[model samples]
Target: MKYLKTRFQWIRWAVHIGALLPLVVLIVDALSNHLTFNPIQAATQRTGDTAIILLGLSLACSPISTYLNWKDAVRLRRTLGLYTFIYAAIHLWLFVGADYGYQFNYIVPEFLQKYYLWVGLPAFIILLALAATSFRGAMRWLGKRWKRLHRLIYLGAILAMLHLALVIKGDALRLSGDAWKPLLAGIIIGTLLILRVPRLRRALLSLRHKPVAPAAVQLASPPAESTLVKN
Candidate 1:
């Protein structure tokens, strides 16, 4: 029991520290001159990837907590989700500022004419809205409506995966790029979605119904004390 509690504490601390590591890596790489590749593109890709990862991680929370019996760890799921939004916002800024130069002339045409842009742009828009309402304050303010709003992330995830798939296939010869990454991401997302099926749900419920042993409780015995007051 003590070990479990300590491990939980460690996980919380680790996650807090890990949250800063991505930004730190970016800054350190820039300072060390190791970030020579297109900085904006790199940032954008990392941000988008991180966002998807967070969404998947958040979705995994319920299954994971159930399996591990670690309900206390559920708070980390929300933290992971917010981190996704952080990276997503960074990705969007880099795309607009670096690629479009904050200019409407170039950006406007792409959104109107490009097919992939139609998918990716709307995905980003939905992400923006979701991120805006991610805070606890917004959750309380919106009450039950917040749930409906947040469900938008599901659509965002689908579009993001599709957009990435389209982008990767855009250049077949550029196999050295993110071709496989998107494919792998899509597969993972698909698996997670499949696990949510009603049949699968019933199967999992049956499995969980199996009997399990209770944990042993450890208690320290109190020290004995003798007194002469009885004499």
Candidate 2:
């Protein structure tokens, strides 16, 4: 109980600190003119990469905790997921406001007509919905549906990869087309996900359920009445 209480306190502090620190850095960078590269692309990439990293972290928490034999690490998953949404929202905002110049007339049509836009915009939309409904309140309200909706994360990842691929394809391509970065990332993420397969899950469960030796089993289980002492 003491550990749990301390963990909760830590979680609250971490959430507040994590949520605010990025905005502070972004502001400082902007004001200090340290935003040296193409500010728009730089910001967008930072936000997007943060989102991907957070999402990966969120996905990793469970497997990590299980392997490490610690239940405490599982507590941070919701916070990680929320941060992912935060970054994803910032990424989408940067794309629309800075990259698109906030011209809906041009933005809407280009987003609708262009193949890359089609790939990315759908991902943003899904992430928006997931982020909006990430709270305990929303989870309770959605009940069984919450999990179903969040399953779209995989789809979002795929779409985001496609978006990145299409964007890079438009850039200067060497003979190789420079396709490996997004592809490799996608493969890593996808492999992490594939570890959740039900057959593999059952096999793992069966392995865990392996019977103990007779001596240990005797130690754990109640002895027979004949082996007990009346005294």
Report the number of clashing residue pairs per model. 0, 0
Candidate 1: residue pairs that collide: none
lDDT tens digits by residue: candidate 2, 11-48: 66876687658777887897888777677787776677
In model 2, the runs with Cα more than 4 Å from the true position are: 1-22, 169-180, 212-231
Clashing pairs in 2: none
| lDDT string, candidate 1, 1-231, tens digits | 347666987887887677768777877876777666676666666667777777677666665565455676567877776777677677777778866799988889877887766788778788778777878899999999999987776788788887777765345346566687677787887676666667886676566553433331123222221111111
lDDT of 2: 0.73
Ten contiguous residues minimizing lDDT sum, candidate 1: 222-231
RMSD to the native, candidate 1?
Answer: 10.8
Clashes of 2: 0
lDDT of 2 at 43: 76
Model 1 regions more than 4 Å off: 1-5, 169-177, 210-231
